[model samples]
Target chain A: MTVAIIHTGCANIFSVETALDRLGVPHILAEQPAEASGADRLILPGVGAARPAMEKLQSAGWDAALVAETRPLLGICLGMQLLFETSEEGGVECLGLLPGHVMAMAAFDGGRLPHMGWNRLHFEIADDPMLAGIDEGDHVYFVHGYAVPVTNHTVASSAHDMRFSAMVRRGSVMGCQFHPERSGKTGARILNNFLEFGA
Target chain B: MLAKRIIPCLDVRDGRVVKGVRFRNHEDVGDIVALAARYAGEGADELVFYDISASPDSRTVEPEWVKRVARAIDIPFCVAGGIRSTDDARTRLFAGADKISVNSPALADPDLINRLADEFGRQCIVVGIDSREIGGEWRVHSNTGDPGKTRTETRATLEWIEEAIERGAGEIVLNCMDQDGVREGYDIKQLTAARAVCRVPLIASGGAGAMAHFEEVFRQADVDGALAASVFHKQVIGIGELKAWLAQQSIEVRP
Candidate 1:
């Protein structure tokens, strides 16, 4: 099966491509919506802020195409934040595929900003296909200053200054605030699971 | 809870990983890609590669090794040592590096940090400071701590750290030259002092002799991460063993 990785022109997508290569999964860098729509699965890999990323996707016609996509699609980091209704970062409206708003993480005493490093995932939906082989309290890498609050769509939750959605799912649309491509073996398993969708 | 990170630093010269005592007397370790993959298998949280010979002439790391390491290992790695501009940072990042660390260049031009943060988000810009205690005060050193040529800057360690953060450095790697490669322990006194002023994630480098050193830094200093070179390169300490010991000490670490 072919997997299409949408190029959002945000940050490096080479790591994600290399992860797919290691998994022996055939993938393509889909700069256009048609290439993405024609693939069996889609991955929206991004980094940087929300507004410019959204503008790139919108200009590339991915916003409308992704909104209408029925196939399994996953968003990573800023890509995940863009799947929501809006973001506190850049104060930009997003794809609205999921029903929530991304807000800046609250600052508490002694808590560092950006919430960088590895954190445990506390699963809310243990049996979801995306988390099939994953266990509770599995550690994943995260680097961000803003995150979405825990909502009904949250499949797993983690905390820095406050608890936030670590992984979210709504039908075929899924998002991971952490970079699975950079999270080591556990992350590799998650990507492999994404490749398994609709197989 | 965010687990404290354990990072293995690889100092590369002529494309071979090397380790030295106090940033001198360099010795070859192994090939870069093999060691990287081995460390990832051993459960290292992340890796940092510093091209020791890339400065003064070559202003950027070779993209070939960065690409090979990215293709070999699945974990996140940071590339440091000779990144001078946004184009250089972009080259490393596009070649698959998760982060770019600036040292001497950032000290020379603090605005380089601001520019890198502006181009690629701050989260990917790391400021690596080589510090040494001179006249009872910690001072920043330039040129990778080469005693013959390394110049001690007038910028105090704490002041530079605060300035770097204000300039949008997402992380700070405090490499204490006095304690580096000595293997006694991490410079807890300096680390604790830096942690107080550092709002960003602080990584302690230079003096990691045993697993307890890692514990001591995480517990007493409360730093976000601890980095070492010789211990892991010489196999004096195993990553799995160190992590298991840290987890038992009630310090959160990736298992």
Candidate 2:
């Protein structure tokens, strides 16, 4: 199967590219929207503030392409936040593929910001194809200052100072707040599931 | 709950893994890629590679090794040393490094931290402080504590930690020069003081001799992670065995 990774130019995509390579999956870095349109799967990976990221997507024509995309698409880290309606990081409007607002993580009671480390994932959906073979309470590496809250679209939820959506799925579009490429074995399993989503 | 991280630091000099005793008397370890893969397989939470010899005049840690390690291991890894500018950090990050750590350079130009944090986001910017206790006060040391290289800064350990966080540092890796490579245990007394002012994830480096030492640092200082080099490189403590032992001690670790 072929995978197209949308290069937003806002963050590094090397780890994600290497992850796909390890899976023995053939993928291409789609710098333009047309290249991504022809792929079997698409992935939007980013890491930075929201306003500038949206501006890059808009200028590169990915914003419109992603909005019209119907195939299985995945967003990682800041890319996941971009799938939401709005973000508090830069107070910028996003792709709005999912129904939620991205807010800064609350550091209540001296909780650390950025929530950097390995945290356990609690699955909210039963037998999700995206989470196949991954057991509940499995730890995944997370590095972010803002996250989406738990909602009906959340497939798995993890907490820092408050519960947030670790994995969100709505039809063919999905997003992960954590970097699956950097989360090790469990992360590899999740990526494999996404690659084999519809056989 | 966020599981406490167990990081295996690889001190690389001229592309070979080396461990030094108190910032002196270096001993070669092994290949960077092989060791990185081994640690990741053994369930290490993360990996750190510091190019000990990287300087502004010399080439930064080659992107070739970073790419190899990223291809070899599935876990996250950070690269340190000689990252003097955003361009240097960008090269490593684009070459597959998940994070870029800065030390001496950040001290020379404190604004470098702000620039890095602004361009690459604070999550990927880590400020490493090499500290030494002198006259009963924890002092921040520059040039990796090598007496031949440079001298210590006047800024107190806590003062630097506070400034780093204020300037947008996402994490702090406090390396206690007095305890580094000693293997007696982590410098809890110093780490505890740094932890009070550090709002970001704090990692304790230096003086990890036994498995109990890991537990002590985690429990007493409540730091987010513990980093050691020789102990794991010399096979004094296996990552798997240590994680299992930590789990048995009621400390949360990724299985």
Question: TM per model?
Answer: 0.98, 0.98
Pairs that collide, model 2? none
lDDT of each: 0.91, 0.90
Candidate 1: regions farther than 4 A off: A107-110
In CAPRI terms, where does candidate 1 land? high
lDDT tens digits by residue: candidate 1, A69-100: 99999999999999999998878999999999
User: How does candidate 2 score on lDDT?
Assistant: 0.90
RMSD of each: 1.2, 1.2
- Tens digit per residue, CA lDDT, model 2, B38-140: 9999999999999888853355879889999999998989999889899998999899898999988988899999999999899999999999888988898
Q: Which digits, one per residue and each the tens of the lDDT, describe model 1 over residues B82-187?
A: 8999999998999999999999999899999999998889899999999989999999988873556688899999999999999999999999998989999999
Per-residue lDDT of A47-138 in model 2, one digit per residue for the tens? 87788888888988988888898889999999999999999887899999999999888633347887899999999996789999899999
Question: What's the lDDT for residue A176 in model 2?
Answer: 90
